[model samples]
Target: MGCNPLHALYLGAFLPRPPPPLPPPGGKQDRARAIEAAVMAHWRAVRDWSPSRRMIRLASPDQEQEEEKKRDLPRNVVVEAVQHLLEWGRQRDQVRGEKHRRNEEGLRPPPSSPQSPSGGSSSCPKAPCSEASQPASNSQPSSGETSEILNQESVNSSPAELDSGVSEHTNISSKEKTPSGLSNPHSQKSEITVNERFLKDYNNIECIADGGFGCVYKAHHLLDSTQYAIKKVKWAIGKEEKVTHEVEALAKLSHENIVRYYTCWTGKDIFPSEDSDSSSGEEKLHKCLFIKLELCKLTLEDWIYSEESTKNYKDDAFEKFQEILKGVAYIHEKHFIHRDLKPANIFISFQNIIKIGDFGLVTTGADDIPVKRTRKKGTKSYMAPEQVGQEYGNKVDIFPLGLIWFEMLHRFKTKSEKSKRWEDVRDGRFPPEFIKAFPTEKSIIKKLLSKEPSKRPPAAAILRMLLVHLFRSSSI
Candidate 1:
């Protein structure tokens, strides 16, 4: 049988080989199972601690007997407890190793230093052949060319960067964010192309996402060498109203919390369609709108599910929520409504600023209410109760803000926890345990999610309530 590592520290301090514990029935797993409630509680405390921190509390040769009495953990219980910590260390090390490997392979490009203010170009990865004009056929850089570009980037990088193992990408999925703050890190899974004209000014075009509307690409500006998110949307030649409404909404609103809109242009672009008859006819060009947008680090949706959630959470939800409210307030003040306000639409920038983007479903009219059939325009899960085939106003935004508040305050260990929390909070009733911890939040959540649209507080009002709550809590 293998030596119990715990025995080495506690028993083998003086002797070369530590004496083994009396073997209990059903082996290690059952011996662990057989531990009583009190012993198990101690095991849990040890299990919860980090390995380095665990070492500090462990028994030392000089103070062995005193430590044993303090712990009150039996030899057998120690064996099982130590096993748990070892497993934790192993898992942590494994994760670190994978991240290191990814860094070495696909070094994340550093964020361009802020020089041109808007461009954010400086001390960053230089784009390959920014002036190289390719033929129309080679408009979009191929996957191979992208790889070569990344390779060239690494080769051209300063020797100091290479030695320091500077990464150009952040593992947002893994919560291993870097100074570079690159989100939706590259993988060759999806093969989408960028518009030829867009490629002329923006090099290193990589598809960030593709949906029914169109695709969003992460690109580097040729002159400024700054990174930007270019959302290239497709509309049926006559059905360009959505794009128009979105542009109008964005153009009217200006706030620090809002996503920065650089510029936009319209053009016709070739798109692959199932209906196209390749052999019989030439490819058709479709109406497309390209919007140059501020490239944010990651969406709020990414932050919620990150590893820091639940117990490890940084608890910056309110701070983030405040910024969202500011942006929404400005939109409402400007006589617009973010009809589709959700975690996915909220963005976090490199400087950790909150930016609200994706105004595709924004509405301009203040008292305008869409028909019953159009109620399904926003995400169903975050949709307000009054928004269902009813005459709703700006307060429609408040309901989802309430939902987002609950999501931020509650610690959901799993996806199921998150889903269940949504169901439980509909009546303004939170779990007793949660309420005991956050006594004030339940009231705010209730006010925001009131069934009547008229009852729901405006974004500005909610901001006041939050500020008041923050002051009260800080004073306490």
Candidate 2:
């Protein structure tokens, strides 16, 4: 018995470690290889295919010649191509949404229980149980089409699927259930369905600032989970017209320094149902009479003036000032003048990126021709000499920038001379001592704050001078 126990102990010590678990049968690697093979097969299937059936080449002049060569695709290849493209698009959208959400940093939350922008009723085909209702009869076909296009352009799909329960009832099947009983081929349209929960949360946002133009609010988009400083034009005819003009102008213009116009939304009445009798039943509907914008932080003016900023973030203010000039430089390069280039109109993002905002006073035309104006625009202090009917053009824009720069550099000047111009000071009425006190590259400041608008440097020249000065100053 003693010999048997000793032998067992020796056997346990001599065990072969179970052959190292047989490398887990290599299942994961095999699965990975299978997936890669399947992907390569799919790529091979679609690799040589052109993006569209009607591929146009610059060299091909004759339409018939172009049509002669078929793509030589597999049967129903177009459908397959479209389906794959859509799926890829969906994946891309998902990625973008995720990136955007992450960037938002929890400023906005997901919508709770989605409801239609109009109401619970689906009078809008996009809404649930809604019938085919035309937009206001007074609305021109052109306007209606434009609105539809804008709406289509603005709507974004979520990274994740909309609550799965509601997703099935959304697109094709919903169309089939409409009261018309006949499907209009052209009638199926994609629309921006602003969930009520989203709109309420967005609209309830705090007012960041208010001005003659409108009230700006810090609103968030629930879908992408992004925040924006929304400038809401007061719901009035004149203000509304200005909003349209700004939109039209910005649509035609693109520049890095200039604030980007994202999308505009306006409300229109949906006609009451002919079959239903609710004439005086107090039916009410509203579309989002709002514009979506890239959310930005406060303007530089507040930062410069704030005591906390003065102590902690003085250098940041100066850096932001340079960004403002870059923005102005871009405007000038485009041959457009931001007639309003004051600190109030310059917006600073959280990342410290600066952009020129408030296009209400911008003008585009030849240098010789006066910037046509029906009425005076801009704050009093920042208005250039030419803006006050002094034959202003591109140079007029830079004057305000110079004054703003002065304001940022020298906080000694108690109040901005916005109510008047350089001429007002040079003419011995407003006191040149105050104007001369502006701390800057002296030569540039002199030219920028020149009495004659024509004598002042154009925005480009000013920008170059300022850029050089900034570079030199930073090096020192």
lDDT of 2 at 8: 28
lDDT score at residue 260, model 1, on the 0-100 scale: 88
Q: Indicate which candidate wins on TM-score.
A: 1
- Model 1 Cα displacement at 41 (Å)? 94
TM-scores for all predictions: 0.56, 0.50
Q: Write candidate 1's Cα lDDT for 322-368 as tens digits.
A: 99899988888887767788888899999989999998878764643
Candidate 2: residue 206 Cα off by (Å): 2.1
Determine which window of 10 residues in candidate 2 has minimal summed lDDT: 159-168
- Prediction-by-prediction clash tally: 5, 9
Clashing residue pairs, backbone N/CA/C < 3 A, model 2 = 122-130, 123-130, 228-295, 380-418, 380-419, 381-417, 381-418, 381-419, 382-418
Per-residue accuracy of model 2 over 344-396 as CA lDDT, tens digit each: 77777776678778786666756535656744567766776667764556777
**Candidate 2 runs further than 4 Å off:** 1-204, 234-241, 268-289, 308-318, 412-440, 470-476
Reference-based lDDT, residue 35, model 2? 37
